[model samples]
Target: MSRHQRLLALLVPAILLWPPLREAAEASMFRHMLVVFPALLAAGWFVAGALNARAQAAFARWNGMGLPGLLYVTVVLTIWMIPNALDLATVNWDVDVAKTASLFSAGMVLALSLRQASPVLQTFFVGNWVTMTIFVGVLFQALPTRLCNAYLVGDQVRTGIGMIVLAAAVGSVWAYGIWRRWRASAVVDDGTGVQSS
Candidate 1:
C-alpha cells in the first residue's frame, strides 16, 4: 500500500472506534450491521496488508487453503446477523466489544484466506454468504414486527432492502468475473494452439 493508503487504513478503525462515532453507528441497526460491521472488516483487511512476512506465513500455514479463515468469518457473520445478537450488542458493552473484535478479525482472515483460496472455494464461500444475506433480508422485510429490539420496524425494513440490494450487487459482480474468466479461457491462441486462463 502507498503511504497515504496505509495511513487511511490505520485511521479507519481508530475513527470508527471513537466514542461518538461508535455510538452513532450503533444507534441504528442499519448502520450497525451494514456500516460499522463492514467498516471494521475492511479495516482488518487493510491492516492485514501491513503484517510482517513471518506473520503472513504463519497465517497461511494455519489457514491452509483458506478454509479455516473463511469458516471463522462465516461463523462470526452468522452470529452477528442474529436478532438477539444485535440486541445484546446494542445493550451490553461486552457483547459490543466481542462484535467489533470478531468482525475485525474476520476481515483480516478473509483477506489472507482469499489470497490462498482456489476459485472454486471462493465461489462456494461467497455464494453461500450471498444466499444467506438474501434470505435474511427477505426475512427482515416479511416479518410484521421488528426483529431487532434496538431498531424500529421501518428501520428493519429499510435494512432488509439494503441487504438484498447489496447481496445482489455482490453476486452480480462475482458472476460477471466468473463469466469473463470463462470466456477468456474459451478463446484459443491460434499460433500456440493453447487456451488462455
Candidate 2:
C-alpha cells in the first residue's frame, strides 16, 4: 500500500476508537450510523489496498465473483441498521467492538471482490442495498416513536432523511457510471460499413 493509504487505514480506526471522537460519533444516532460506520468500512477498504497478491488470491478462492463478499456486506449492514443494534452498539462496548470489526472486514471484502464481479452482479447487489436503505429510511420517518433507546425521535427522523439522501446519491453515482461506460462502448455503423465514434 502507499503511505497515504496505510496512514488512513491506521488513523481512521484509531480516531474512531478514541474516547472523545467515539463519544462524539455515538452522541447522535445520525452520526453513529452515517459517519462512524462508513468510516470503519472505509478504513477496511484502505487495508484492502495493502493485501499481498497471495492473500488476494486466497480471498478470491472463497469470494467467487464477489457474491459471498457482497452477501457478507449486505448481512452485516442489515443487522447494524436495526434500531436495536444501534442502541446496543451505543451502550454495550462489546457489541460496539463487534460492529466495528464486522464493518471493517466487510469493507475489505467489498474492495477485493467488487472488481471481480460482473456488471449484472454489481447492479443486483447495489440495487438491493439501495432498496433496503430507502425502506429503512421510510420506516424510520414513519414511526412516531423512538426505535432506538439511546436516541431521540427527532434524531431518528433526521437519520432517516440522511439515509434516504445517501441511498439516492449512491444510486445516482452508480447509474451515472454505468451510463458513461455504456456511452463509451456504443458504436455506430453507416450503410457503407464505416464506423463512427
Candidate 3:
C-alpha cells in the first residue's frame, strides 16, 4: 500500500473511535466539543496532503517526501488530542472551546509549514507561532479560573501535562523553522544545486 493509504488506514480507526471513547467519559459533552476542532483539523490536513501528493505524483514528483512528513505530523497531533482512556470529565464547554481553538491554530501552522513552494510559508509559520504562543500562554495563565470547576472534578495533572506537552511541541516547531532557515542560508549551493532564495 502507498504510504498515504497506510496512514489513512491507521488514522481512520483512531478518528472513528475517539468520539465514542470520549462520550463514555463523565464529561462526554465537553470532551466531544474539545475534540471537534482537532478532528476537523486532522481531516483538513489529511485532505490537503493527499491532494498535494496527488498533484506532485501527476507532475512526476511522487517521490517527494514532504507530504508524507506532513501526514505523519498530523497523525502525531491526532494521537495527542485523543483523551486518555482514564480521563474523568468529558465535558467542560469553556475549556473545550479554548482547546479546540488552539488545535485549529496549530493545524493552520502545520498547513503553512507544508507549503514547500511558498516563501510565504515562512511568514505564516512565524506568524502562527507568535499567535500560538500568545494563545497558549493566555490559556495557561487563565487555566486556574477556566479550569477551576473541572479541576475540582477531574485529574488536573493530566490537563496540565497535556498543555505542557503541547507547548513543547509548538516550541519545537518554532525552533525547527529557525534551524531550517539557518541551514538553508549556510549551504553554498553549486551551479548544479537549487538553493532556496
Candidate 4:
C-alpha cells in the first residue's frame, strides 16, 4: 500500500476516536454494536500495518501464528459483543479507554493473524463472525426489553435489524468470494473432444 493509503487508514480510525464521532457511535445500540466497533478495528488494521510491521514480522517468523492467535481474536470479539460489556465500555471512562486500546489491538491481531492463517481457518473466522452477527441481531430484535443500559428498547431493536442486514451483506460477500475461488480451482471440460480447464 502507498504511504498515503496507510496514512488514511491510520487517520480514519484516530479521527473516529475523536469525542464527537466516538459519542455519536455510542449514542445508540446500533451505532455502538456496529459502527464504533468496526471503526475502532479499522484504525487498528491501519495502524498495525504502518506501526506494527516489526512486531508482525517477528511473530510471523516465530513459527507463524497458530490456533492461539485465533483464540485470542475470538475472545476479544466475544467479550465486546456482550451487551453488558458494551455498556461498561461506554459508561465507564476507565473501561472505555481500555477498550479503545484493546479494540485497536484486537484489530491489529486480526490483521497479523489473517496474513498467516490457513484457508480453512480463515473460513472458520468468517463463519464465527457471521454466527455472532446473526445471534446478536436475533437477540436484539426478539427481546422485548432493552439489554443495554446505555440505549433504549427501540434503539436495541433497530440495532438488531441493522445487524441482521449487515450479516446478510457480509455473508453474501464471503460466499461470493468462496464461489469464485472454487470456480477458479474446479476442472472443467470444454467441447471439441479435448479436456480443457
Candidate 5:
C-alpha cells in the first residue's frame, strides 16, 4: 500500500474505536448515536458524490479559494468554541471536557462547510476528529464505569454522541481531501508524461 493508504488505515481504526470506548462511561443511547452518526455522514457523502457533480465541483472550488477562506473558517470556529468552553466551567469536569471537545469539533465542521471547500480544511477536520477519538479513548481508559452509572450528573451520553457525529463530519472531510489529492496527482502525471513523450 502507498503511504497515504497506510495513513488512512491507521486513522480509520482510531476514529471508529473512539466513541464506543467513550460511551462506556455514558448511556446506551449515546453509544448508538456515535456509531450511527459516522455511518450517516459516510452515506451522505457517498450519495452526494454519486448524484451531485455540482456539489463535488463546489468543494473543489472552495478548496482552491486560498487564505481568505482558511482565515474565515479559523476565526469563526474560534469565536463559536469560546462560549461553549466557558459553559464548561458550570458543569462537571468530565462532562465539561467532553462537551467542550464536541463543541469545538462541531464548530470546525460548520466553519469549513461555510467556507470554500478544500482538502486542507479536511485536514483540520481530521485533526479535530482525532482529538475527539483520543478524548473518548482516554475517558474510557480513565473511567469505564462512569458511563454505566446513570446516577452520574451532567449530559455525558449526549456529549459522547455529539463527538461521534463530529467524527463522522471529520471523516467526510478527510475522504474529500484524499479524493482531491489523488485527482491532482493523476492530472500532474498525465500532463508531465504527455509533455515528455
Candidate 6:
C-alpha cells in the first residue's frame, strides 16, 4: 500500500487513544478491555507494517533466536489481560502509560513472531491464546462480584461476552488460515513445484 494509506490506517487506531474515544474507553471495563486495547494494538501493528523493512528484519531476527522473545511477549500479554491491570490503566496515569506501551509492544512482538513462526507453531500459539480467552471469559461471566474497582458488574458481563465472541471469531479465522496453509503445503508435496487452486 501507499504511504498515505499506511498513515491513514495507523491513524485509525491511534485515533482511539484521543479524547472522545479515550473517554469512552475509560468509561468502562468492556470498552477498556476490548475496544481500547484492540485499537492500540492495531495502531502498533499497522505502524510496524508501515515502517521500512528494518523493523521486519529485526522481528525476524528476534523470532529466529527462539523462545526467549516469544516468552517475553507471552508474559506481557498475560499481564495486560488481567482485570486489575485494566483497572490500573483506567485510573492511574502511570499505569495507563505503561499499558499503552506494553500493549503496543506486545502487539508488535506478536505480529512479528506470528509472521516468522511455522504454521504449526502459529496454530499452537493461537490455540493456546484463544483457550485462555475463553477461560477468562467464563471466569468473568462467573464472577459473583465486580472484579475491578472502576467497572460495574454489567461492564464485566459485557466484557466477558466480548471475550467469548472474540475467541470464537479468532478461532474461526485461525482455522481457515490453517486449512489454506495445509492445502498449499499439500500441493507442494508432490515435488513438481506446482500450486493447486
Clashes per candidate (backbone, < 3 Å)? 0, 0, 5, 0, 6, 0
Itemize residue pairs with steric clashes in candidate 5. 25-147, 26-147, 62-116, 62-117, 63-117, 63-118
Lowest lDDT block of 10, candidate 2: 183-192
If scored against the real structure, what TM-score would every candidate get?
A: 0.91, 0.91, 0.44, 0.84, 0.34, 0.84
Off by over 4 Å in 6: 8-21, 65-69, 187-197
Residue 164 error, candidate 6, Å: 0.7
| lDDT value, residue 161 of candidate 1 | 95
- For residues 6-84, what per-residue lDDT tens digits would candidate 3 score against the true structure? 3463353244346654345434323333344446466545544444545645533531334443444444454333444
- Pairwise lDDT winner, candidates 1 and 2: 2
lDDT of 5: 0.45
For TM-score, candidate 1 versus 3, the one ahead is: 1
- What TM-score does prediction 6 earn? 0.84
Which tens-of-lDDT digit does each residue in 54-136 have in candidate 2?
99999899888999999998999999998888889888888888888899989888899889899999999999999999999
Model 1 over residues 40-124: C-alpha lDDT tens digits? Answer: 8998898888787899998899999999999999999999999999999888877887888899889889999998999899999
Model 5's number of clashes is 6
lDDT of each candidate versus the true structure: 0.87, 0.88, 0.46, 0.77, 0.45, 0.76
- Residue 116 alpha-carbon offset, candidate 4, angstroms: 1.3
Candidate 4 lDDT over 86-139, as tens digits, reads 898888767777777777777877877876887788789878888988898899
RMSD of every candidate to native, in Å, equals 2.1, 2.5, 9.0, 3.4, 12.3, 3.0
Clashes of 4: 0
